[model samples]
Target: MTKGYIHIYTGDGKGKTTAAIGLAIRAVGAGKKVCILQFMKSLAYSEQKILQSIPGITLITLGKPYFIAKEGMLTDEQRKTWGNHIRIYPAGHPPKDYREMTLKGIEQAIDAVSKNYDMVILDEYNMARWYDLATEEETEKILKARRPEVELIFTGRNAPKEILDAADLITEMKKIRHYYDKGVPVRTGIEN
Candidate 1:
């Protein structure tokens, strides 16, 4: 209907990626083409397997699962936990490869959109921009150039104002409270 559109999920809270994945699942159920590109997250959760089981849905994970911490932002325990999440590839260091793969994934997603996909999810893409792995300018350009017939969704914290302005629908997950703040670690099937 109306050649599809754009949906943005942002703000400081959980459920951004979960919401996007829910939409992806819905689109697939309705027999629509769907693709999800998750940046900064490696495939380690049950959702990866479940998503793979869905027909007409494709998922691409870009980058190693290293934690994004500013200097002195995390304690040693947090650093260790993050370290355990790091993903290493067989071909030496993976940061460069992650960048290249991400770019390629974006290009491929654009192509899929142009080819008449129903929905595309750029999961945690804002984090990529926030971390300087992807530029806001480039993301803006891509959004501007997206096919009118494609419905796109972007999920992550700190989405730029420009993106919010351009989006047809925006959902912000404001953090009221979370278990993590109560010393609860992210668990599989819940926060992964």
Candidate 2:
């Protein structure tokens, strides 16, 4: 029997989701079943196409068509890049649709673990906890539900202390250098 570990990819940097996707690809290549649930994002990136075409990988995104941004805070580049899906708001409240989507995603996490998937990746789930869309306690409950053989992964920035404490492995992608800070737009296949 295989022993699965709980891992977290987090921090104020890039590549958290990318790292999870890499892990998913590795898992699939090794003949393991994988379930990838993306939270708070709806952009159709190039990888989505590849992941969909790949066998043994199930990918689902729980988010509105629009992206969330703090009102009056979007840079010119941000507005230009995400012009189609900008949901700028004055308050701190996340959109109701995103909340609903995330709640459903949480349920799906429980279901995925119960079904004995080899690996379950909850991408950007820490954002849900950060925005109060889901509580740390709720996330903890899902972690508890995972079977001993179910590999669980959480990815995002601003992960709660409780979540970090619960993880068997945690990798923080610290942003020491980033081109995004240099006014370069997101590359088509690299950062999109």
RMSD of each: 4.2, 2.4
Q: What is the TM-score of each candidate against the true structure?
A: 0.85, 0.88
Best-performing candidate as measured by lDDT: 2
Candidate 2, pairs of clashing residues: none
Error of 1 at 133 (Å): 0.8
Cα distance off (Å), candidate 1, residue 180: 0.8
Deviation from native of the Cα of residue 52 in model 1, angstroms: 0.8
Stretches of candidate 1 exceeding 4 Å from the true structure: 70-77, 80-95
Residues 64-141 of candidate 2 have per-residue lDDT tens digits of 767777566788886998887687765557677777778898999989987869999988889878766787767877
* Model 2: ten consecutive residues of lowest lDDT: 87-96
Candidate 1 backbone overlaps, count:
0
Top of the candidates by TM-score: 2
